[model samples]
Target chain A: SQKIEQNSEALNIQEGKTATLTCNYTNYSPAYLQWYRQDPGRGPVFLLLIRENEKEKRKERLKVTFDTTLKQSLFHITASQPADSATYLCALDVGFQKLVFGTGTRLLVSP
Target chain B: GAGVSQTPSNKVTEKGKYVELRCDPISGHTALYWYRQSLGQGPEFLIYFQGTGAADDSGLPNDRFFAVRPEGSVSTLKIQRTERGDSAMYLCASSLASADTQYFGPGTRLTVL
Candidate 1:
């Protein structure tokens, strides 16, 4: 089975700073990696997706990088705001058939 | 247009009871999925339905877990003999295709006492 791990359970950062979250996986090679944001009491919303062939992808202030060699993906939010304080999740596609998600890392952006 | 909707926003039941969670996908979506999210954890895949049949149900934890997508628009996740461990938010998502972007619903929070 594939195992996904987020770097931390929670992260605290100040507004205007860049919040970077890490996701690592083992025992599998995924063709696509995705990032999502989940607020309290709500389901996750898709943020970005990066394919194995692409080293990096950006959407507005959000950026994602996939390092297949290291079996890891990094999610970054530039100029973080209090609204960005939410649980961010990373998911990997299983043979492009299914998706497996990590536990997620909660980001707390303090104003 | 509605993204997705789930019935019974919350449910409370006793152990050994049977519970059903319902999901309504977008009007034109052909792929639907069911997942369970425990406290502080991400959503775990339970089943995937392509059209009217289940394409993959390998994520179902046990025999007690079953899902159906009759008529290809609505789905129901049925759990028999529910246990305390079954308490979690049951989520449903839908996409245009099996591997397309999935849009999730508010979810039904199930509490087993």
Candidate 2:
């Protein structure tokens, strides 16, 4: 069975520190991967997108790295702030704009 | 600018009853999609529409689930003989076109009792 996995446990880090989240998948080849931030009782907001051919993509304080060979993508938030605390989701384009998303990892940046 | 919006932020229905959830996509968006998300799980695709036609309905769990975009703008997801398992967050999204970034709505929480 195909699966997209992310760390279910909440990650805690002090403010101003860098936070890293991992997304791994099995049995799927995706051309494009996207990251979104979702707050409680709200919809997901787009953050960044990285293509398979590109090794890394960055926007402002957010950066994403994709490794097609490993079927993994890592999301990083530099200079993390308390406002950055939320569930971050990784989604892969399964063709025709259909997205398969991981469970998401909760990040908590405490001050 | 207005974003995608879903109606009845929350809905409670009885088992075996019928329910309808509405989605209003952003203007000029040609693609619309429906998904269901359960607790601790990512949103699962249910259907996709391109210009008022259902281009993909394979994600629908069963015949009981159906969606329509009569004017290629506002959409409605209809569920027949709703079951407890149908209880989940029904999300709607739209994009400028196929393969483009999708903007999602806040979702409609459906509870089947």
Report the Cα lDDT for candidate 2: 0.94
DockQ for the candidates, in order: 0.79, 0.79
lDDT accuracy of residue B98 in candidate 2: 48
* Deviating ranges (above 4 Å) for candidate 2: none
Chain A only TM-scores, each candidate in turn: 0.96, 0.99
Which docking band does candidate 2 fall into?
A: medium
TM-score of each: 0.96, 0.98
Q: Pick the candidate with the highest lDDT.
A: 2
Query: CA shift at B71, candidate 2, in angstroms?
Result: 0.9
Put down candidate 2 lDDT per residue, A18-105, tens digits, no spaces: 9999999999999999999989878888899898999999999999999999999999999999999999999999998789889999
Clashes in each model (backbone N, CA, C under 3 Å)? 0, 0
TM-score of 1: 0.96
Q: Each prediction's Cα lDDT score?
A: 0.91, 0.94
